[model samples]
Each structure stands twice: as C-alpha cells, then as structure tokens.
Target chain A: MIITNIETVPGRTIVEHYGIVQGSTVRAKHVGVDCVAGCQNTFGGELKGYSQLLEESRNEAMDRMIKQAQQLGANAIVNVRFGTSMITQGASEILAYGTAVRLE
Target chain B: MADFLFFVVFVTAVFFIGQHIQKKHFASLEAREQALLYLPAVVGRKVFNDDDVERAWLVHGTVVVSGDYFKMMLAGLIKFFGGRISAYESLLDRSRREALLRMKEAAASEGAHMVVNVRFETSKIDGGNPSQQTTGMFEMLTYGTAIRLKAQ
Candidate 1:
C-alpha cells in the first residue's frame, strides 16, 4: 500500500475511508548493542546501533499497519504518525497509525 | 581520589572535543542546507495539482545523537537548579536540523522538487537506563511526502 504522512496523497483523490489503523511493536537492545551504545555515550557521537534498532522497529510497525490497511481494501494510507515510549530500561514501544483510504 | 581525578580529566577532554565536533557539524550543516535550498520542504498538507506533478512518494530521515559527558554534566547541574538547560538545547537543535537535512537529501536524490506534510518524531533512546538523565541520547525522525513536478 502507498503511504504518505499527509492529509492526502499527492496526485490522487480519496474515494473511500477505512477509518484509523494502527500497529505497534516493542523492541529491546541486545546486550552487545547496549555495550556499544554505552561506549557511544562516553565518547559522544551518533549511536548507530540504537538508530538502526529504532528504524527497524518503525518499519515493522509501518508494515503491520500497511497489512491492516490492505485488508481493508485501502490502496493508500494518509496522515500517518509515529509514537514512541520507553517501556522499560532497555525496551521501547513504537506505534504507527494512519487513516487508510482508497484512492482513484 | 583517583576516581575523582579521572572524572575531572575526562570531562575536561570531552568539553574541548565536543565543542570542536559541534562546530564542525554546524559548519557542515550550513553548507548542506545551502546546497539543498532549491528544494522546499513544508509542513502544509497541500499538494500540487496532478497535472503538474510527475510522481509523489514517502521519504524519511532518522538520526540518533548523544551529548558528550561535559554537556550531560552541565544539564544535570541545570536540572538541579531548575533552569533552562542550554547545553541540551543545542543537542536537540542539531539533531532536528540534521534529520530534516537528511529528509531533504533523500527527496533531492529522488529528483523531487518539493516535500509536504513534513512531520517530526523525537524520542530518547538511553537504553532505558534508570540513570538515563545523564545519557542524553535522542533519536529524531523526519518524514514527508516528496513530489516530483512535471517538467514545464
């Protein structure tokens, strides 16, 4: 399904609305990754491992949302948004939500 | 005594190194922004007419940045005093600008002329360590719809 974080997908008109669809996942850093991140904190720079981990989680959440949208027969998702929360010491919950719509 | 001595030395070293790195990063961000000024990234939901648009797609950029020890320590002190933590402000500012720059770069690489409905998501990724206050790591993600207009 096509996805855009806007009210309407460019070059397309929405014909049907599937309401709101959402997907979420919780991810924890591996011990090795945590060790690497600790080093990053001490030395001060981009935390590559954490960035990768969050990016993967976000993609997974988006995929799940897309699957739901597809089940609703929607061809596109609009006004998508992302939310994040720290669930525990090392785990975070990533949520992706959007309005699924059919475009013509 | 030795522990305190090492802590002092580490903070001093990080202070200088962090300043240098931040200066370099700011310089680079300025140059890259100048290079990408042709592309307009706006937060409006409006899109160009279909006749004038060739294609549109989603694009995003994510960055995870951590503050140096010196800044973290400074933030901690400011926190205790309940005042504005300027040290951390720069950290957030840099990451946000960097994230937006990356999104713009992505759009440019796709030959897009404009980006719309830009959104930002900021999260602290401190490994959830209870002492995360001092870790001062944040992840900034910027996403938008990139529109490539038809050539006139």
Candidate 2:
C-alpha cells in the first residue's frame, strides 16, 4: 500500500476519500535494554535499544493503519501523520493516522 | 565523608564525559548539516513548489539520547531554585538535530532531491513519575515525504 504524508500521491490521483483511519500502539522496554540504556546514560550517547523500540512501534502502528485502510476499500493513505506521547513512566504510545483514499 | 567523596567523583566524571560527548555531538551535527545542504527539506505544511511533479515517499529518522546523572542532578537543583533547566538544553538540541539528519540521510539514500511537510515528534521514554528509575531518555522522530525530481 502506498502511504505518503503529502496531500496527494505523486503520479496518482485520488478518486475517493474514506475519512480518517488511524492506529496506535503502546510499548515498554525490556529490563535488559533498560539497564543497558541506564548504563548508556553515564556516557550520554545514542540509546540504540530505545531507538529500535520506537522504530518498531512506529512500523506496527503504520501496519495497523494500513489494515484499516484496506477495510475501508482504499488502496492508499494520504496526508499521513505520526504522533508520539508518553503514556506512562516507562511506556509510550505511537500513532499513525491518515486519510484513506481510492486511487484513480 | 564517603558520600561526599563519591559526589565529588561523580560530578567530576559527569563534567568530563558529558561535556566531551556534548561537544562531539555538536561537531558532528555541524559537519552533517553542511553535508546535507543540498536536500530541500522544509517544515511548512504545504509544499511551496510543485513544478517538479515527481515521486514522493514517506521517510522517517529516529534518535534516542540519554541524559547524564550530573545533568539530572543539576536540573533537580535548578528546579528548587525556580530557574531554567539549562543543563538539559543541549540534550534536546542534540537529539532533535540528530533525528533530522537521519531523516535526511534516508531521503538521500533514496536519491530524493528534497523532503517536504517535515514534522518532529518527541517523547520521554524512561523518566518521569515515582515508579520509574533514574534513566533520562528523550526520543525524537523526524518524518516527511521524500520527493525525487524527474530528470529533465
């Protein structure tokens, strides 16, 4: 499925808009990465563990959003947007939202 | 006396290591920013120029950075004084810029000439509240659509 944050996809036309479809997921890190991330804090560098976690969370959210688009009979999602919020002490929520559309 | 000695050692370590890391990060950002001078990325919600009419794809760059204990402690002390938490400023700056650079790199790899509608999302991963530990993590996600211009 084609997903672009732009209002319209390049080289394609939008025939119908299926309102807004969205997906969100909440995730918390494991203890091993938590300790490693803690140790990483001492040196003040990139926390690869947490970065990967966020990336995974983003992709999962996107996947669920795509499924919603599919259910709406849309082939693509346009004007996609991503959001992230700290849900709790150790957990975060990542959201993917967009306008599903049938392409011409 | 023992606790005092440990604080002294910890403060010294934070000073050396934290400052060193911060300096290195800025230096890298300086170089990378210069290298990415050609990519036409902007934060505007709408694309200003539409003449190219080429391919566009979604791209994202993510970065996570941790704060040193010294900065955390310094922020704590500043909180008591009701002043700005300047110690953590560099941490935010570093993560945000790094995330943007990564997004640029992703776009560049796709042979994209520019990125548009760029937006940044940030969140705290391992701090805040009484249940969590002392790990101070900030995550920045930069995402946009990379635009590849058609060859003339």
Candidate 3:
C-alpha cells in the first residue's frame, strides 16, 4: 500500500475524515532477558534482544490499527502518528493512530 | 592452596553461567523476528466524499531521538561496529507499520484493493542533548496513498 508521512499524497485527494482510528500494545521484559540485559549492561552495547522485541511489538500494534481502519472502510488514512509510553521501568507501550478518509 | 583453587573454579563456573544466560537471551530476541510473519497486514483506504477526482494524501516519516542511556549505548555500539549511526531503525519500523495500516484502512474504506506510488521520507523531530538524559527519544513516520485496484 502507498504510505507516507506527509499530510497529503501528491496524486491523491483526501475526501472525508473518518475520525480517529488507533491500535496499541504493551510489552514487559521477561526474567530471562532481563537478567542477561543486566549483565550485558556492563559491556554496554546495543541489546539486539530488546531492540527486536520493540520492533515486533510495533509491527503488531500497527497491524491492529490498520485492521481497525479497514473495518471502517476508509480508502486512506491521513495525518498518521505514533506515540510511545513507558508503562514501567521495564515495559513500554506503542500506539498508532490516524485520520481515516476517502481519496479520489 | 587447595582452597584458592576451589574458589577459582567456582568463580569460573559462575562466569560461564552468566555468559550462557546472556547467550540465551540474545537467542530469544533473535527468535522474535521469526514470528514477524504473523504481524498484522498493513492496509488503509479512503473514499472521497467531495467532487474532487484527484484524491491524494501525503505519507512521511521522521526519526526523533532524545538523549538518553539507550541512545548513547546504541550510538556507541554503532561506532564500535564501525557502522553508521542507525539508531532510528526502531522509529522507522514503527512509522512504516503505522503508515501501511493507515493506507490499508483508507483503501478498504473506498473499496480499493491496492495502493500505488508509495514513497517514504525521514527527518528528525527533536535533537535532545546527550548531557541531559540517559536515553534518547526519536520518531519515524510513514504515509502513503490508498487506491482502488484496477479492474481485472
């Protein structure tokens, strides 16, 4: 699908605002990874572990948001945005939202 | 001398255990990417209620990173590996996913089956100070069109 962050897609026109649609997910660190992360901190580098976890969560959340929009039968989403909340010291949540609309 | 020898062995064992745990942790994270297939499909659809026939929407993404512990660590790792600073992958991935969903929703709403002329852009939202925080915050954005698939 055509995706962009710009307010307007060059060739397409936004028809109507379908209100706000969103999807989100929360994640916590497991003991296995936390223990290792604690030690890995000593050497201090990219925790490929945590990074991948975040990536997975983000994708899931986005997918859900898209489904919600589809259910609404919007031809496009405009002015889309993402927000992240640190739920706790070891956990965080990612949210995706956008304005659903029809395009010509 | 015997006591010293036993202490050394114990310490060695603990060290190995820690290493093993760390290795396992890394392995688990790597395994996560495998389930990526089950991730939701990105889709968006829109219908123009107005008379304008040239419907279009803009999709763009920006990667914002604030200064923090995680940001520094990531930067250090990139430097250590002689790799370019790509601390924005997380943001990019997030944006891309969101943008796709938005597009899908828009398309589905308009009874469109596909989107076209997809494009992407990246930018910085905030340039936080490294001295002020332990980690950095950044953003990535993605946007695109939701179009009807041409009739077969």
Candidate 4:
C-alpha cells in the first residue's frame, strides 16, 4: 500500500474517510537489548541499545496498523501519527495510528 | 601469573559467547518473518491529498526478553553468527506489523477496504550512553495510504 507521512499521496484523490486506526505494543527492559540510552549519557558515536529496541517496537506497531487497514477495505490511509510512552519502570509502549480512506 | 592468564581467557570466552548467542537468535527470527502487501489498481487511481491525510503514524513494537520462548531461541542463534544486522531485522518485522494494523483501522472507520503503495522507515534512537543499560531501545515507523477499492 502507499504509505507516507504526508496527509495525501501526491496524485491520488481521497473518496471515503475511515475514522481512526491504531496499533500498540508494550516492552520491558528485561526483554529488550542490554544497552545504555538517553541523550545526556550517550558515548561518542556509538548507537545505544534502547534506541534499537524502540526502533523494533515502532516497526511492529506499524505493520499491525497496516494489516488492520487492509482488512477494513481501505485503499489508503491518511494523517498517520506515532507515539511512545513509558508503561513501567523498565518498559515502554509504541503506538501507530491514522485515518483510513477510499481513493477516487 | 597463571591466575592473570586465566582471568583474561575467561573474559574473552564470555564475550565470544555473548556475541555468538546474539547472532544466532536474531538470524533465526528475522528469517522466519516477511512483510507482504496487496495493492490493487482500483484503489490506486484515487487522487489523495497529502494534507487531507493529516497525521503521520509512528509505528513501534518489541519482542522483549521475557516473551516468546521460540523467539528467544532464535535470537540466540542469530547472536552466534556475529554482527548487529539481526537487530535491524527484528525491528523491521515489528514496525511493519504496526503500520499495517493502523492502516486497517483507518480503512474500517472510513468504510473502505485496502491500502496501496505502503512504505517503511527504520532508525536508531541513539540514547547515547553505552554504559547505561536500563533505558536503551530501538524505534521503527511505517506509513501508508488507506483506501477503498472501487466496487465491481
């Protein structure tokens, strides 16, 4: 499917509007990679382990969101948004959401 | 002298073992999952507005150390092989799942079906500190258009 951060795909026209679609997942430090994170404590040029964990979580949520849209019969989705939060002392949650729509 | 030598050997062995496990596990899991998409022309012809779309989705997920025994085994195999590529694959699979689910929900709300020309992105959060172990994690984001296919 045509996925983009932009509200609309360049040449396509939206026909119908689906309310809102979302997918989310929660993760904990014990289940994640062993690495140090946060902007304040990063070593020189090395990539932090937490950063990698967040990336993985984000992708999983996006995939689920797309699958749901397809099942709803939407040809495309618009106005997509992403969010992150600390669910517990050592865990985090990632969410993906957008409006499903039919195109001309 | 013998004590010092043993310590060096022990440390080296631990490092190698950790690297090995990481390689083995990542490779197995990454290979098992693949991203698939279905885009039909009827849905493709619609003229969609970028701004009308409104929001940009940020999809994310994690396998975690505590869940899925099978996945943990796979990760261990990946670690055995060496390199950090396995980590990327793990995150990629998760991001794809999230993006698709969100798209489906959007389509349902609009009373439409199907999404076309799906796109994906991957990035490292770079929390910065290598010494800090509790706050590190990777992030992935996938975005795409949700549309209704024309009726036959």
Top of the candidates by DockQ: 2
lDDT of 2: 0.85
The lDDT values for all models are 0.84, 0.85, 0.51, 0.50
Interface RMSD of each: 1.9, 2.1, 10.1, 11.2
**lDDT head-to-head 1 vs 2, winner:** 2
lDDT of 3 at A11: 55
For the second chain of model 1, what is the TM-score against the true structure's chain B?
A: 0.91
lDDT of 4 by residue, A1-104 (tens): 55554466545678777778888888665432442323212211122365455667777887788888898888777667777666655566788888888778
- Model 1, A7-58: lDDT tens digits are 7766678999999999999998889987887776765667888888888998
Where does model 2 exceed 4 Å of error?
Answer: B45-51, B129-135
**DockQ numbers for every candidate?**
0.60, 0.66, 0.11, 0.10
For the record, the alpha-carbon RMSD of candidate 1 to the native fold, in angstroms, is 2.1
lDDT of 4 at A90: 59
Specify the CAPRI tier of model 2.
medium
lDDT of 3 at B99: 40
Q: What proportion of true contacts does candidate 3 retain?
A: 0.11
Worst 10 residues of 1 chain B by lDDT: B125-134
Candidate 3 on A10-73: residue-level lDDT in tens? 5566776678888899987678865665444333333445555655776788778778878887
**Per-prediction CA RMSD (Å):** 2.1, 2.0, 11.1, 11.9
How much lDDT does candidate 3 score? 0.51
DockQ of 3: 0.11
User: Alpha carbon lDDT of residue A5, candidate 2?
Assistant: 91
Model 2: per-residue lDDT, tens digit, A1-104?
88889898877778999999999999988899888887777767788998998989999999999999999999999999988887887888899999999988
